[model samples]
Target: MVPPTTGPTHHLGKSEIEYYAMLAKTEVQHYSGTNIELGTACGKYFRVCTLSITDPGDSDIIRSLESA
Candidate 1:
């Protein structure tokens, strides 16, 4: 039989979601007014995005990290 996974499913809270959003390179917004209100306090620092790593070598590096 298959064994259980290491940990329970942990849902990301609004704060955690915002945290990652801020780390992203673009603006992150939610349609919900509640999210807007909460995220607003953080100022414009919070946003949605990604860095352009066009170097093909990066793919190999990413794969290595995922395997690790």
Candidate 2:
């Protein structure tokens, strides 16, 4: 996978690195919706204080939140 490029501000940047790292190291079960406290869970990624996708479609939204 390509390394993530740095963003303009330090706090807000591409999640490619984090996502891929989670993809590689975090177990699928850790992502279950029941585990809201898990950092890798879908809920954490969608938390309003965090981030949002641009122009995401229905399937994209599902793919982002519905996956474990």
Candidate 3:
């Protein structure tokens, strides 16, 4: 599962999604793209500041990200 976050909310230290993810010790992947780009990649018609990839499936997404 991937959960979205807003830029302002995160910067203001009021992002509940980020807080919960930290508590759960989950890895947070920061997309080096704008909110609109992130949203587009996720197939959403909105903005996305941040996102957590809970499951990477059978792909080498994690490895590729690390490499990048």
Among these predictions, the greatest TM-score belongs to 3
Q: For residue 54, what is the lDDT in candidate 3?
A: 67
Q: Once all C-alphas are superposed, what RMSD does model 3 give against the true structure?
A: 3.3
Candidate 1 residue 15 Cα shift, in angstroms, is: 1.0
Please report the TM-score between candidate 3 and the true structure: 0.56
What is the descending lDDT order? 3, 2, 1
**Deviation in angstroms for 67 in model 2?**
34
- What are the runs in model 3 whose C-alpha is more than 4 Å off? 1-6, 13-18
Best by lDDT: 3
lDDT of each: 0.34, 0.36, 0.65
Per-residue lDDT of 20 in model 1: 57
Q: How many residue pairs clash (N, CA or C atoms closer than 3 angstroms) in each of the candidate models, in the order given?
A: 5, 0, 0
Ranking by TM-score: 3, 1, 2
Residue 53 shift from truth in candidate 2, angstroms? 30
| Model 2 lDDT per residue over 22-54, tens place | 777632211222222332433455322223343
* RMSD from true fold, candidate 2: 12.5
lDDT of 3 at 30: 57
The whole-model C-alpha lDDT of candidate 1 against the native structure comes to 0.34
Better of 1 and 2 by TM-score: 1
